[model samples]
Target: MSSFDNTHITALTDLINKAVQDIIAEYASAGRAVPSLDTLESGLFQVPEETPARLTKAIQIVEAACAQLSCTVAPPGSVMINKSLEHEEPACLLVVTEARIADLLLDKPEGLPASELASRSGLDTRKLTRILRLLATKHCFKEVKPGVFANNRLSMKLLSSDTVSSIVCLLTDESLRASAYLNETLTDPSERDGGIPFIRATGYPFFDYHKTRQGLKKGERFPRAMVGWGDVTGKGLLAKVYPWTSQPANTTICDVGGGNGHVTMNLMKAHPHIKVVVQDQPQVIEMAQKFWAKEYPGAMEKERVQFIPFDFFKDAAVQGCDFYYIRSILRDWPDTESELILKNVRQAMKQGSRVIIHDTVLRDAVRTPESSSNASVHHDVAPEPLLPNYGVARVRTYELDMTMMNLLNSQMRTLPEFIELGKRCGLRFEKLYEVGETDLVEFSPI
Candidate 1:
């Protein structure tokens, strides 16, 4: 009946306390206090420099150790049940987002009664109270009083206005539905003809499904969701992490399969000297045109941006650009199709041309000789008593890996996988850039 012995518990306790001290010190050094979870604004992590190496490591250790410690002490059945029901919290979140509860409570810092909130959102009062209470217990929204609900720092992110909400809805609705069919898709032998779980759930592959009349109505939210995808995955820091300023003036940076051209827009805004070519399907190109026009009219006026409708699977990317950037594109396809896409970009490369792929580069839970060899980018592993991949701290990337598989029968590649994929396309691994949430793998002609 006893859990991890004294030594194990002590190790975890020490790790947590050490991490907490490190975090507190970092805040003190910055002349700032550790942010309150209730405050409705950006926290320390918003400022990249504020979350430097020491602070980041500490935060990871704290997250992993605390969760591990809890699991170590908790009943096995209790933990298993909690993990099994994880989907329910997000389902509640979907309800809150769909009802615009966050937006309604935006002005009500003190909070709103559950009955009033339910009436405004057109939901049953008792049901709404239960949902809000569940979310509150999860630290999303807060139950300020006996039956009153309010927006907290976390709930503010669910505000209908934020781009994060788009991705949230997509994941909770379409992706969630697709995920439900994962077991069926994996088991059914007849499902092998490019019929991913998403297709099984909707009777069409992701793109084709989105093109249908019903899909079209829902797909309108998708472009913005793609934009929100960038925001959620730390694409805003892409320009800063990479050496955009080092490139020559007017250097053309081609954004291959760039939906809404969010990455290039960030680059152009940060380093306006660079010219950009945003390439995708004709429909996406059309969307990119409007997006660029509305978001950065001056760039469109000055011809600093170009919209090129090109399918990577069938056509070469814009030739001879200094950098051909592909953000979160390859993860949507299996290795065979991913290679074809890369080969097209490979064909378009000139002597100095480089391909920069921005996606989740997964790390193994334990170190290996192969992982060591492919270590172009240094990923910090957690110390003893924590999962090597930082367990709950880095679970989002692993969850996204599952999401890719469920939706497209694809995966987020490991460094070794990425290196091999590039080599197959006649490209050599150059270097890897680790932005907080994702990794950028750079390649050049073989």
Candidate 2:
């Protein structure tokens, strides 16, 4: 690997040019205009599925190259200064999202003045100006003049109607509060509940908090927020990554803890031949049934997909499923509970059965990634001087890791860690699928 110096500048430039040209060619072929930074239509932040894969990689490379170069040449205190001001960004977002400032500015093409905005929103004018200006500098909003703000594409997406806004509020509010207590959990082992920070901050486990949280029917928001987050960060990777096309006509997949069965809905929509049984708690299953009834009536009526209530901790009643799929479930518990969840799924398997686990498979900066050792798991490691695990490019890996610890005293696992846990329940490693922010590993009876 080359040092982080100008010696690699030409190579970076060439890579950037190639990706740019490739993207332009695709747009030209499609008879579409190349999108600009001023517009949200072209960016990769929360792209639609119809976007071309090569273009996504191209945009990512451009951002990574620019960021890597900027960091390398940055003077002392650059990193530390960034760390110190981190809280301010989330605070700014929390204010705007909660206050519905984005919605207020949405249709005002001429831009909204600060004083008027404050009057309408019932916020103090001076305080609101400071908050909006901070985010406008980062392209989230546009400061048309000294004290006027307008909704740009990024900010427009945060309108009160958007679910991503709810996610932003949730992460930066309760989740953020819980994150501040991580050290308390790590060090104060003797303090009650083994220092689980989410429980410490919210007085309820993460899932329980979602179930009992009161608001605009808080029960519905958590699942909807999850789908929004998955779209923004992951692009519904589970829907895209699996080889659903290859599944046999009779293939059956049991979606364990599949809240509202959104993932299964996507799968059934894409691959009609694959049958699915989505399981969750009784209440969540009720929600899923209503969802399927409204959104995918055919799938439910045809019996190609259905929602069933299953408590993951109990012995399995689901039998003869070709694939038992779990997503974002295990990371909500420590190992002992996680093992029990696996053992229950184990009890229902027959020959040719496989369990597909969809969650984050964290890679260490120093250790070789499991993808290198397993032909089945495919992912992109950062090129050249960038960290192999994508460094700052994928810091969400660690962010979610902390969130897991804060909420449940659980963890995102390394391959070896996952293997060890699976082994405890008479399951063996079968294969792995590297989805976006998460991984899908298949395990079978030893």
lDDT of each candidate versus the true structure: 0.86, 0.78
Cα TM-score per model:
0.90, 0.89
Show the lowest summed lDDT stretch of 10 residues, model 2: 40-49
Candidate 2: where are CA atoms >4 Å away?
A: 1-5, 8-18, 40-48, 207-220, 234-239, 367-373
lDDT of 2 by residue, 294-410 (tens): 999998788888667888898584888999988888887789999999999989999888888888898777536464665755766666555567666677788878877776777
Pairs of residues at least 3 apart in sequence or in different chains that clash in candidate 2: none
Q: List ranges where model 1 is wrong by over 4 Å.
A: 1-5, 47-53, 192-195, 211-217, 293-304, 369-375
Best by lDDT: 1
Assess candidate 1 and give its TM-score to the true structure: 0.90
The true-versus-predicted C-alpha distance at residue 246 of model 2, in Å, is 2.5
